[model samples]
Target: MRNSLRFKVALFFSVLTIALLLAQALGVRALAEAQEERLIAALIRDDMTNVLKGYQANPALLPPFDVRMNGYVSGADRESVALPATVRNLPFGTHEIIIDEREIHVAIAPMGTAGTARLYRVYDFNIYEKHFKEVINALMGGTGIFALLTIWLSFGLSGLLVRQVAGLARQVKTLRLGESAPIQPGKYDETELAGLVEAFNDYHQRMAGMIAREKAFTGNVSHELRTPLTTIKTSCELLEQDAAIRGKSRARLQQIERAADNMRELANALLMLAREDSACEVEPVAMAKMIETALTPFADRLAQKGLQTTIDIDGDLHVMANRPALAIVLSNLVDNAVRHTDRGGLHFRYAEGWLSIEDTGPGIPAHAIPHVFDRFYQAGSPDASPAGVGIGLSIVRKLCERYGWPIEIGSEPGQGTRVSLRLPAASRT
Candidate 1:
């Protein structure tokens, strides 16, 4: 009922094969039975004629008489036979009698005597039951040969079709996301499967065009936003330069300006990460230097909170990655850590090719670690609320993936939290 081609074909062919079998079986059986019936009928007719002639020649043959012939014939077959008799009296040229438990025709000719019938004779082909068995075996044997050929043809056709279908599946799997146009599959003319490939390719083309347009729009929005941020930051610096507003208001204005800049940077990161095809220039960024630059701006905040900052990074341990991305990652982390810790210290360390940041504030709960890097996923903690857009860690994870870096998170409730930045070393490459 589903109308799928393979199912329909299988069902139709199987039924056809069965039909062919049944027809052959019935046809052969009917033909053989007719042939045997005619064969028995002709023999009975001749034998009945001969016996009637012999009885007519002898007028002494009268009532309560019986006649028999040799039970076996040795030439064509070794089958044993039994002569048959009619239960009722007959007057005619032919009569029907049982030939070895099978109904067969016999001929009879009687002369003289009106109600009694003076002369009567019967002859039967008595091996009809044995002949029936032979015919059945022969019909069944022919059916078996035809059935085998049907199965072979069915398998051959299915194999040919399945091979081409499997090839199409393989090609579809390796299709790339960055191609400007969808793949045009190899054509198989005048086939329903070929039409299906064309339909899929048409849909793919439309989807690719839509994705490209979205990327262009997002990139344009990010660039447009950066221009206004730069102007506002410059205006803030000029406003802070005035001697009149220097004491308190000028500082507050600068902070407002800095926050705007951070927002602009965050927007840019979102744009770049939105498209998986986005590419960036990789550079060797000194792990220690990058951490120092990010932490320097937070130094005053740490000092005010009476929280110690420790760094155990070596001289020039480096990672290959986009510098702007690295800056955003560390900026968000250091900012979040400063906001979270009131008294306890924060430590930054690098070992092998991994940079780790650990904070003494109440760490993330174990259950929350799975979703900690997800966008807009923030546990109901004080740090998650303050200085958080919930997109920072998500951005960090994306950048780490672009850099071929693996990120690890370790946290325990009421203890501490540690985030590790693992980079593939130059030697590994």
Candidate 2:
């Protein structure tokens, strides 16, 4: 909770408000105490003056005041007239004293023409002390109530602010890689929040435009290149049929044909990948035919390396998928297998909705296996063959991810590598 911005903002304001309240309470209590003291002193002096005048006129007529106050007259033969030693010898002035564990405020003045006669008026200090305490308690109680209200208000306001920020964050997170639509500006009363939403909307528009342009360019280039590639492939096939071409020259023409076929497959894959949607028609595809078509372009390479190929799938087994997309996936996988194996055989198997390709080549190192599907990541060492640009496996991984298929690769140092592509149950059906 402490990491949350709303919590921090509320806490900050709450502490500040409490501190201010405490300071104000202390200042007000001090001022009240000073005023109370002055008022008590004035009342005491006035009462003493009135009693002295009445005593001079008729001493018996001046009855005792409230029990909280007492009047003492020196030279009078009365118990109340006998003052404590602490105040008995004091001069005519106001004094504070404690007698019999009771605090008193005293006012002394001359009583009569006799030099020895004097008046002492005393007021109980407990009354003023109790009232001051009550005032302070009330102030503190009010401060506490106000503090709670302030904290609640702070949390409410901060929540409103943080909610706007969180909404913006969620919108940005939902902007996927292929999303072409721009984000809409959110409605907010706060100027800063509205400005932030506006800025994000602008950025979203620019990014969407850039992605659309990139996809268009890729599609156009791939489409334009396909016509010429088909022409070259057809010309190469025609030349291969000529009786005059033979030996090394015929092999060169065959290589050109294989290269052209690979190029066409790559172009088709690029066009499919560049499209924003995967709405191609799904149809039942024969596993045997798919494998045969994928392997045709690699026949020259497999023959050159003397690598034996094996297929262990039922002839009637079929998978449901978009034909062109699945073609790219299978071709890339086959091409990767053919490029790596220098000797021994390549094997394919289908069981339990999984299609696996096993190759008996120098196995990928354990450290390199994790990054083998990354774009342009060479598995072991630099290959002298021009075929290993390291993007075939990456494209295969991308297609599998798009179709929600799980792909796994297992390899040991000296033993060979096996790649398994787990198809959906619906695909197998």
Candidate 3:
């Protein structure tokens, strides 16, 4: 919660409110105290004048006295009157002093010949000072309450501020490529929010157009390429029946047919991968049969290398997968293993839902194993295989990702490599 924008906004408002209220509370207290002091000073001045007049008329007259006010007079000699040392020598003016820890405001006035006689009036309004403090404390308490309320309201306001952004995030999260309509900017009233929505809409349209163009290009290219391949395979079959094509000639014809078949498979795989809506129907596929079919093109190379082969899978074990996609994945893996292995055999094993292919080839380096599935990242030597453009494992990974299959590779420098696939488990055939 502290990391959220709403929380930060609320905290900002809370701090600002508290600071403003505290400053206002202090200002009000200072003003009230200053005004009280001025009022006391003014009353003292009036009392001084009255004391001078009363002494002139009656000679022994004293000034008024109350819980909040006091009066004193001094003789012309200044020593005849018993005045506090702090105020005795103060000139004929009002002055404030602390006498016995109590605040006092003293006012002095002159009268009689040569202004020798002086009237001193001191006022103590500590009682009212205490009440003033109580009022200030109450004001501060009220300010605190208001600040807290403002903080709570700020949290609610922040939620309203981010509501549109949260809604937009939900829409983007659920959006599917080339399936959903563009987000409408008109729904948002704020100019910045509307502009943001419009930008996203533009991006969505561009991505959809690019995907459509890619599907069209792949589809067209694959169609155009496969036509010639199909014709060549048909022509090879017709020639194989003729007695004139024998021995080496028949062998060459068979190789040509196999090449055409492999090319057609490549085109189909590329086409399926390029289209966004190319989800194929899944069914129970015989894993052993599919493996044998994938290895057919590599048979000659396997024989030439004198490499042994082991298939430790149950013939009746079937897996749930798209036939064409699984075929391509198997073919790529088999081709990679065959081209690299010179003296050792290829081993296939199945357990539970996982099918693993272990090869006795010069194993991939530990450092290079991580990038073996990356496109165009050749882990073998340049002369390893003519068709090793480094895209085989990349395609296998992509198909497995699309179909939710799990694939992993483990290898050591001299111990060969093992590639594992976690396919959907099906009932035994």
In order of appearance, the predictions have TM-scores of 0.56, 0.57, 0.63
lDDT of 2 by residue, 288-391 (tens): 77888888878878998999999988888887677788889888888887877889988989999998989998888999999999999887655554566677
What TM-score would candidate 1 get against the native? 0.56
lDDT of 3: 0.80
Q: Quantify all predictions' global Cα lDDT against the true fold.
A: 0.69, 0.77, 0.80
Residue-by-residue lDDT tens digits, candidate 1, 105-133: 43444444443333333343445567678
What stretches of model 3 exceed 4 Å from their correct place?
A: 1-148, 166-184, 246-251, 277-293, 296-308, 314-323, 351-354, 383-387, 404-406, 424-429
Which 10 residues in a row give candidate 2 its minimum summed lDDT? 68-77
Ranking by lDDT: 3, 2, 1
lDDT of 3 at 321: 92
Error of 1 at 157 (Å): 7.9
lDDT of 1 at 235: 89
